[model samples]
Target: MEPLVEENKKLKEAMNRSEKNIQRAHRERDLVESNARDLEYQKVVLSEHLATVKEQLRSKSEQLATASTQLKDASEQLEKLQKVFEEKKVLDCVEPETAPQPDGRPPRPDIIVKRCKTAWESFKSFNRDVVVTDATHALAVVQSHYPATDLEVIGGGYAKGLSEAKTQRLEDEVEDTAKKLAGDTDLFGETNGSGEA
Candidate 1:
């Protein structure tokens, strides 16, 4: 009976040790699972961050491409304007002596004033000539003594002559004004004669 009791006590001790080992294993498994969950959450956050960064990079790249294209276009336009300026310079040097010589450089204020004065004088001369011719024709028609029909014919001739002279003067003035304005544009750094601001 004493041996049986000692053997039973030994069995009880072995069962307690087995139960403690099983509990330890369960605790270890739970810790491992918790760590795995934490790692998975971190991976998800990192993935989202990476996606956001990639999107930003793509947007910046597109903007850079657009800016580069605009820069290229501006450079091309500048080249074209430079070419046009060079051609205009050559033409200016070859112009007649009577015209103002801009000399491919900005004209002085005094030179601009002189050119304006010359243009005004030309206009005044043309106007004086027209006035003289009209006066002469009027005097001639008034002095002529003729039959009523002939007088009418003479008056009509005078009217036609005056009208033609006026028209011709107007046309000449318009052409001269255009030429002066074109020169003024070159002196003032404005665009071509088409009047673009």
Candidate 2:
């Protein structure tokens, strides 16, 4: 009976040790699973951050490309405008001298004014001469006297007496004024004489 009791005591101690070891193994497994879950959460957060960074980079690149195209287009338009302005400058350089060289320097403003005055005088003389010729005709119809040559010469010849230079200048002035009224347009818009912004 004493040997049986000792053997029973040893078996009970062994069973207790086995139960403790099993509990320790279970605790170790729980710790390992908790660490793995934390690591997986960290990986998921890193993945999200990386994706957001990539999207932002793509958006910025697209914006940069759009702005670059706009800038290039604006530069080309500016170049075209500058070229138009240069052409207008050249035209301005050629615009002032209208009359032939014989009537050039001394007769620029003075000759133009003189031609205008001559035209006015010729118009007034034509009216006055016609009135006189008609009065004479009415008198002749009432048995008065006047020459046909005088009427013919007075009616049309008064206007033909202007110098060729003055006549040419008057025509040129009309042409120049007409051309000036017809202006030019450019990229920005129209200008007075030159194609500037």
Candidate 3:
């Protein structure tokens, strides 16, 4: 009877160890399943994002191509106009004395202003609805008014709705905020006199 009781005690101990191992295996399996579910969710989200980005990229590429073509056409028109203007500007080539010509003196400020106004009017007459052409003409006028000067242009691009512009602005603001958070402003430079954060 004593020997049988000792054998029973050993059997109980083995059973207890087996139960613990089963519980441990179940926990491991549950953990693996949870990780797999999370990975699947992430994959779905990433695939959706990729599709959206590809569509946007395609649209932007088309827009850029169109803008490039418009710029090329505008440049060609400008060149042709310049040729015609120079040809018409020259007086009679036969006699130097009788040649009616512009005085070689430098143009005054008022004269430059008048030329700019005339150019603006011509561009408007050509196509006021065409924004790229309009902007190019405006820039040309500015450059003609300030010859031999490098100018800075800002906030000029595709004609878009206010909502799209606002969305882009918000995205830019978010990007800027992220960069500010990651970087030290002191390392780059100081703030303006306006005391903005």
lDDT of each: 0.52, 0.51, 0.53
For residue 130, model 2's alpha carbon misses the true position, in angstroms, by 60
TM-score of each: 0.47, 0.44, 0.48
Candidate 3, residues 1-197: lDDT per residue as tens digits? 99999999999999999999999999999999999999999999999999999997775544333333334344555667656655644332322223233787543344444565567557544543344444354445435644532333122333344366564554453454333322332322465544344
| Local distance difference test, candidate 3 | 0.53
lDDT for each residue of candidate 1 in 125-179, tens digit (9 for 90 to 100): 5544544443343334333421122333332332333465664454453444333
Ten contiguous residues with the weakest lDDT in model 3? 90-99
Query: Which residue pairs overlap in candidate 2's backbone?
Result: none
Model 2, 1-197: lDDT tens per residue? 99999999999999999999999999999999999999999999999999999997765443333322333333444566556555545333333344545735453544555565566556545544544443343323322222222333332321445676764454454444323322231322454445544
lDDT of 1 at 164: 57
Worst 10 residues of 1 by lDDT: 145-154
Model 1 TM-score, 2 decimals: 0.47
Q: Model 1 segments beyond 4 Å from truth?
A: 99-197
Give the runs in model 3 whose Cα sits over 4 Å from its true position.
Answer: 91-197
